[model samples]
Target: MDTDYDVVVAGAGPVGLTLACELRLGGVSVLVVERLAEVDTTIKAGAINTPSAEAFYRRGLLPALAAVQEENLERISGFMAQRQGGRGGPVTMPPRFAGHFAGIPLKGRLLDASDPDFTGAGPAGDIGFIPQEPLERLLGGRAAELGAEVRRGVELTGFEADDEGVTVHAGGSAIRAGWLVGCDGGRSTVRKLGGFAFPGTDPSITGHQAMVEMEGAEALGKGWNRTPTGTYAHGPFPGRILTVEFDGPPADRDAPVTAGELQASLRHVSGTDVTVTAVHTATRFTDNARQAADYRSGRVLLAGDAAHVHSPFGGQGLNLGIGDAMNLGWKLAATVRGWAPEGLLDTYTAERHPIGAWVLEWTRAQVALMRPESHAQALREVVAEFSDTVAGTTFFAKKISGVWQRYDAMAAPGDHPLVGGSAPDLELADGSRLADHLHDGRALLLDLADAPAIRAAAEGYGDRVSVVTAAAPGRPELAGLLVRPDGFTAWAADTPAPTATDALGGALARWFGTRTALPTGPRAA
Candidate 1:
């Protein structure tokens, strides 16, 4: 069957755009259709966690992220000054600002960076403050640069998928594609049309987040505050307010948020008559957590919010979606490019479903702690105390930072500690890092101790894998490593060449398929 593109991606949000870029990098054609003519400027996620940052870093996008972070830090500094009544001069983010759990601050100073999850994580291991709007724009541009076609104002109204290819109806035109992916967000049209079963807990809270001009705002306390009725936070930035009430989900979630409605919510949660005067932007949210029963069905697939969703309490939504894209992109491309092993594409759901489930439960836990009941308040106090200790702070930091995220299925039984985890940015003898070699999106086999057997194992994969011989002086125990396109360590060898060859060969075959007759052209250090 003739297809317009190898993959047709619905929605040009960060997830879709990032996937488009990845598919393009993997040498597959991708078409990204966004319903909106322009990027949405709504206030969404304020930061990207460690794993998300590291993903960007591996793709050599860290310089762009750093630029965005600098701008955000300046804006944050100004907001801090305004919060302090303009007395402080250029207030910077507190050194202890790791992140929060149930609105409880986790101090960075108390966190042990030497923990196994964190050691050798490199510079992108920290949380990066780049809001959703800019992030989408960045990824959108990157997708285009990588040769993915992005069409705006193209709504995916329907699609028909069979054993061969998918015919997608968008913007009153039917386009054919080898595969279709839904990144269209919570109310995903692709997911609905594809008959994907979504199930999860119902919401018990109605939350309001907005930026507006208001009167009597001084009556509300600054930062996160839990009252007898609910929880409210005021002013990290002037006119920025958020309130959560356990009064059931909004009657009309799609209804426009008016200043009067926000005022009432603020009054209810803050127990003060803070009058909202002029509303600039506002939205309603809920703890409506849900996950698709499966991420794929035949040629139709789902990623980002189309696959899972939960409360935005811990700022995990965008990061989680980015992860879905990173995990799905190369695998889908491999399948499209015809080198994927049997059931390689099926591993997407197997590897990512568990992570999505964990995020849902993590958000639900925060919701439980925020409940207006007296018991919840007591539980919050206990959790708060736990967060204050060194171990507790490190634990929460690992979770919030995304350092704790590892794919158990990606590892062999009794694998090295680095297996299933992001490859440490090992600096080679030539002063280059592992990430420096991954910009082209090929799998990498790093030989630290000049192992001919390990190098021979990576041969015949052609350009699918790049073998680099370099000594990583920092990690003397690591003799060799197989790093996947997404920067996960597929295989690690601390033993000698003979002992590691068979395992290396198995990993190469498992991920890159059967070895070909292509010449072994190992790149020099």
Candidate 2:
């Protein structure tokens, strides 16, 4: 074992790299391990959500991802077919959900940013899907730039934790760290070695993925337009209709996927696959699974796929991982820097665990409807209707596009009028934008309403807080909302309230310290 680094993260996927970068920014000496000799180049996750985009944007890596693939998918819900006991049935789409069914959103998000509550504006906060490998390369470089020690061909064999920290085994040697995070995928050795229990339901069906250059399949529609046996997946990716088919049974991720097996399934699902000019790769996987019982054990933590596994039905697995890293990053950094409370570490599990379950709940319902059928007719009808519901459409759009992530579950206090809401681009007193002011990657309080309460709170704290006052209502969209650094609501107040100063001050003290928890301080001019 070697001397202790501040942190050690296993599995250098995008999530892992992001976590390491966040820790490095907090002055943590980090070591990142990956079993693969090189980064993966597959375009696995084709979509990026807003939270991930925002996180990457903060780190200046979104442009790299956007440069690689800039196809923008706006709406959400789509159809995925599954096979049941070798019985081929009708293609049934998950119900259209009429307008905006909350139930469907609980499934997979449809691809649209049509929600009224959603403000899709503010300096390009949108989701984009790119292949995972290249995405990691870009992020890994950024992580290394932030001082993370990235090591390829190294693997985390195991780890031992005590009251102080953890000693990680990787690269044929032992490495000590103040903390460890497992960002490895579903078949996580870190999860296994830590004796953590994965408590969630199993996937209903397995999926066979093939990056085949099929002859005549054209991605003609917005969603997965099917032809009996195959699905035409036209995404942000150029010149490729991601063609997929459901075959006999779901195989383990550890199991090998073959072009031959996928070719046969294409014939079964599409009814006439004809021939594959080139099978880039065929892989079998399932849509089932959820989170670990705990995200932290002693000094060891888990993020990304390591903490949760799910049917990629809504393209959520990667997004989920990204979200996990984001959720843990700031809190870990805050704790490391002494700004956060002792219980902040526990919030990672409490906050993110529910989100993991939420992903599973969304995917499980969506996967169930994607069952294999003799014909594609039934599936078409389902997509058509799902294309109509608020819940379903919002879910799909939010899931695939990454907007459905409402930060209500974030542990920051929510009683404030605008605490758990999204902050829009507002004009500051100097006419600069509120978002531009947040370039520091920290929590921001914009006194757009010019509420006396907020003015006084800032004065009371002095250098402890950086408060920006907007001259007038900035976007009209976020007129009364108090946004957080994570682009979520912290506490909101009526700007023109007579007792607004006292009310707002009390609200602020609740989350940021004594100031936000108790607002009895005198109002500043």
Candidate 3:
């Protein structure tokens, strides 16, 4: 049979499914092709980060996934670090990883665990983990519900593309689309076929994730406890423990690491001859460092591991992949509907490439510190208590939690309101949050009673922009906020100052372009 879609996405993993879901919501014809019959059971154990959650929230996927998770895990699981001079304790915990950048304000009291008001919700904060399989299934179902064509058991056999569109050859059939995205993971055929090269630093970490059903896990622990700097317990599940270690490396592709290999590692590390009766799921991996030289190549783009792979220090894998989907989804939709500047598509790479590299370099440093040499071990322990450099515990939590992702995307300090993380939850006069309002598929305008400027700033957006003047109670200084279709804060104006005024137009043109045409309604028909 032959099917032609607006976009054909390969590898129905979390990233691909997310892209499909968001595109389908925008009324874009999308297809997802996966060779596997079902989602895999092996878990990429970690919480879904705030930035990632925001990305999903933008697509209306977060609430559903959040409902399924065991609340949100918002604590920083400390890691040990070994130094060259002498391994000491983990570096000193800095203030809630306010940020690596010097001048950023301290957002958390790293030392004060009792600060109930404190929160770890930023690009660099803890994620909500509900297992990748369930997440993928949910995303797939959601995408299908939104009209994405999911073809399972369909292998990607070939592809041919030009400026006009992309034609995907899969499962002994032909599928065409305006664009093709490869979320297919490492060794992506689309990347290779598109001649996109992955050039970057070191190899990625090869580790296995196993759910150990300890008879008395609660008796042992609950959260990520210190098992020394070299290793740590991610968390003791109900009679279970999710673990990832720095193994040497996986063998060749023809010989992927198996359950038995993980079993051996468990026996060696845990010692005392503890028996691993069952393997929930086991896999091997390596090479913690790699990013595509760029994210785009003609009509084919890479997302998830397809575009970048790095040490899993931040639990960034799936989250980063989903972010890619969120970042590209609206842009793709606008382009297809004839509302976006062509250059906007290229910005995906410009915006995310540095982020990929930053995460990689940061993870590399963490890995270097995890070395188990005698002196290194001692230093890691001491530093855990004292050091205040980038290697400190405070920084580690913020870094890996993904709070450290500072983007040049928004140039001026106070320029664009949405420069940082997803838009903050602003309480409306009616108690509804600014976040809740934009859940409908639409571009949001947060009007801080600045009608003339808000409208003047937003007028060029045409019918494409649904202007909502958010009159934030009490804080009238918050003149306005621009909410992107994906739910991230694009522009926030505090009191409508002149310095930041120019940035409003810049921010709009950056993502949607000055010429973007909003749908007649929030939901694209």
Candidate 4:
């Protein structure tokens, strides 16, 4: 079937844009369509986790993220000074805000940065507090620079898929592509029309998160507070407030949130007569957790909130969607380029579905601990106590920071511990890091001990994999490693043994296809 592009991505949010950038790097033609004419200025997702930050670092986008974080920190400092009545010396932020669990603050000073999972991560080890707006803009700009075509004000109204390709109808016009990915968010039209089954628990709480101007704002306490009605948190930034009420979902989820409505919820949760004077921006969310039965169906696929959605409790939504983009982008591009191994595209679902399911459960656990009753409050106290200790703090930090995430499906029999895990950003002899070599979005085979055998094993796939021979003095125990395009370690070698070379060959063939000319057609059925 003739196609206008290799992949047509629906949505111009961070996830879709990231996927487009990855595909462009893989030399695939992609088009991204967004219903809105401009980027949404929503104050969503105040931070990104470690894995998401590392993904950006590998693509050389960390500098952009750092700039955004600096601006956000300045704004936060200003808000703190305002709260302090601008009296004492300039109030500074804590050295690290290691994130929180169910509103329980995990002090960054208590976290052990020397943990094994954090090794070689460098500056990307820490979580970044970049709002959703700037993150989307950054990804959009990168996608554009990579030559991914983006059409704003074009909505995916419907689509039809066949064994050959998919015809996507957007903005009253039909466009053809080899694959269609729905990054269009929770209410994704592609997901519904593609017949993906969404199954999960319903929501029981309506939460309000907003930035506003309020009268008698001082009446509300700072930080997280639990009352008889529900829970409320005030002033990480002045007028930046959040309240959760055990009142099911909103009556009209799409209705615009008003000052009077927010004021009533604040009064009920804060137990104060605080009045909302003006709402600069506001959004309502719920604990409605759900996941698609599969991420792909024939020529159609889903990513980000299109595949799974949970509460914004742990700030995991944006990070999770970014993960989806990184995982799927290369695989789908390989398929479109006809160099993908058998069932390569299918692994997108196999490796990511479990992670999505786990995220759903993680958010549900937080919601369970946040109930307004005495039992949940008692449980919250015990959990908070556990979270304050060294071991407990480390555990929560690992989970919240996303360092513990490993793909069990990517593992082989008797694989090294590093296998199926994120590759450490090993520094080379010339002082360049592993991420520096990965900017081209190709698989990497790093030969730490100058082993000709390891390099020989990667010979056939030179077009798809880059071989780097560098001395990693910090990790002398290793001889070589095979890292996928997404920075996951596919194989690791302790010595330049023949058996290690054989394993490297197997991993290469498994991921990059056979040692022959690149196929010009689809995989043989």
**Candidate 3 local lDDT, 392-427, one digit each (tens):** 535544554554454457456645534554566566
Among these predicted structures, which one has the highest TM-score? 1
Cα lDDT, all candidates: 0.88, 0.61, 0.63, 0.89
Once fitted onto the true fold, the runs of candidate 2 whose alpha carbons sit more than 4 angstroms away are 1-3, 71-114, 215-256, 373-383, 389-400, 409-417, 427-431, 449-465, 475-483, 496-525
lDDT of 3: 0.63
Summarize candidate 4's per-residue lDDT along 276-387 as a digit string, tens digits.
9999999999999999999999999999999998999888899999999999999999999998999999999999888889889989998888897889999999999999
Q: Give the per-residue lDDT of model 2 (tens digit) for 83-174.
A: 22224555443322112121123233443445643464344454354566667778888887777888899988888898777888888898
Candidate 2 at residue 318, lDDT?
Answer: 83
RMSD of each: 1.4, 7.7, 7.4, 3.5
**Model 3 off-target regions past 4 Å?**
1-3, 71-127, 201-206, 212-235, 238-247, 252-260, 386-394, 404-406, 412-421, 460-463, 496-510, 514-525
C-alpha displacement of 16 in model 1, angstroms? 0.6
lDDT of 1 by residue, 344-425 (tens): 8999999899999999999999999988798988999999999999999998988887888889998877778788988999
The TM-score between candidate 1 and the true structure equals 0.97
Off by over 4 Å in 1: 89-92
